[model samples]
Target: MTDSYDRVAVVTGADSGIGKATAVLLAEHGFDVGITYHEDEEGAWETAALVREAGKAAAVRRHDLTDPVRAAHVVDELAGELGGIGVLVNNAGTGSSEPLLGMDYERWRSVLSVDLDGPFLCAQRAARRMATEGRGGRIVNVTSVHEEYPRVGAGPYCAAKGGLKLLSRVLALELAVYGITVNTVAPGEIATPMTGQEDRVPRAGSRPGYPIPRPGDAREVAAVIAFIASPAASYMTGSSVFVDGGMVTMGPQAAGALQSGDWR
Candidate 1:
């Protein structure tokens, strides 16, 4: 039997963290991968090496998704290099936590540029390429738990992520005609270099608020993404898959509920 991902996939911010994990996983699943990095060409190369190790073709490129023109060029180049793009993973993002009262317009806009606008532009370009190629595609936006719920001091991150959720839905609805599926994969606290390792334990210990009672791993999130980007997920689109281990369902009072409610 032939694999569903014999084509190609482009994963942005693939230098490290969940982006890196997803890129590696997809490559392992028989998809040639285009790995994009901002300033970390070495990291991108490392990811490419892993893709090559998976017996898949790999292309490493530099892209600053915050710049629309450059981002478009990056997509065109990746499609050219990879032969064609079968999947687009908008996983490039950064976040900062600060009180809304002290937030500057520049910082807020920066967050939106990376977390929201970047994905939309990349997805639009990739979707157009897929539509023009007359072959269906998958677009997965690596969003966050804050996409639906708000957290303290993370106003900008929350705003951008929330916007991305709707963007994914809108694209999903419109792209359905083109046989292209669009969806969001929202993850909770996962242990990644970006999440500050020294503080990871403390953050995870607070997971009494999480129904799973434990933090997740990058590989776990990667697996979820790989599935979403596969042919098996054909009927799934315009949806946000929460890989948060049931944290979103419990809300902030989850800890209180767990502490006071039945053990069974």
Candidate 2:
């Protein structure tokens, strides 16, 4: 059946991938969940149904979080509906793959607005409500390993995630006095709709450069988020935990070793 926590959580981009996983996991952990979707009402309902099946309340809203004002309002409405926001998971972000020199102003700004500004607005609104509630809260950002590393064609995404890393740190420090904790979960390659890999992974033919031999599961990342939102993680704040399966720690030569000629 469904587990139940007294806390309420707001998970943005709950239609698919990591966001959906987080929302369902939070429901299983007993938190009444508020989910936001950009244009996928069907997916949102599916997520809400999962929460209900888990025996918790679920609220779904539509939002395009690039507009900071509207995004903030969305958080406000969700908080009002859910009674109060106890956990805010900033997982609503998009990515673009373009070289710095090839990127136009609009593309860069779009990535930053969604990845960084959206989180700022949502966190601000949620934290305000959380402070008024007189109880502690949790804000977990679903960042990426690219926040610290570099990818060839994803300069804009990397920059935005890097900024998000610092944003989480700053918010954690400023909101600590209010009894709130802020942290980030940087995930590696996970099998999800976003990654275009659903149930099974194709690995028979090549099996190239992965030291772990397979991508991570979305539920695994959700487990980390669930822990951060729980009371057990009260002492942790402003920290970034990499769940990338040693991908980030691998050296330049590591990928080569997996290749036949030691070069990709």
Candidate 3:
């Protein structure tokens, strides 16, 4: 899949939250973007507008990542629409608030399908295209702080992200022969609609357990992802980058390891 679009990037779940910020940031950095969202057409259009505002081409797709075939096809579809793809950001994911014992089997499956299977399929599809293109590519997975440690009431989420972290390393090694770089970006307490705090900036006391004094902004995480997708990160792969404002490094005590929800 090749197109006239230069430096095109594919960002899943770009309708809102960190995905929205990632798409817009990639555009600002001279990448035409193909954004995907599930059940949020309006939000997808809004994100596309941001990409266009940055003087880059934008395309939107409604993606349901539960099916492996469909998950992979979205990347191909978006790459076709955008002309080509140079970077792939697997930012689409879902979490379960129910504890493990209370969580039904369907709920567990839903979380894992979208968070793990979907990204794996998407990465495989995107990697093949990049390798075949012979121009090298960037693959960045947007994981979570749970990837490093357990989160209360979020067993499925933690499992999926932890799996993805390891998957990034495997992809990095497998794709290295093709000059493709794969990495994971783990974020903590980001201000987004997902956290139900889109209207306000992350404050120091918002997440009292965090030592940073403020919740992280979506843009902060996006910036780090953009760097990993850039040529500047050519030498990095099989590594995990934390955008948690020192939350992960602070250990469980200082960061309130027992707390769940947005603080994680």
Identify the leading candidate in terms of lDDT: 3
Model 2 misplacement above 4 A:
1-6, 199-208, 255-264
**How badly does each model clash, as a count of residue pairs?**
0, 2, 4
lDDT of 2 by residue, 53-92 (tens): 9999999999897686787799888888888788999998
* Every model: Cα RMSD to truth: 4.5, 3.7, 3.5
The lDDT per prediction is 0.85, 0.85, 0.88
TM-score of each: 0.90, 0.91, 0.92
Ten-residue region with minimum lDDT total, candidate 1: 197-206
> Model 3 — which ten-residue stretch has the worst lDDT?
1-10
Q: Give a tens-digit lDDT track for model 3, residues 1-264.
A: 122223999999999989999999999999999999999899999999989989999998889977756768989999999888889999998887877878889889888999999999999999888888888889999999998888778999999999999999999999988888899999998888887787356766766666786889998999999999998888899999888877777784764556566653
Instruction: Give me the displacement of residue 198 in model 2, in angstroms.
Output: 1.9
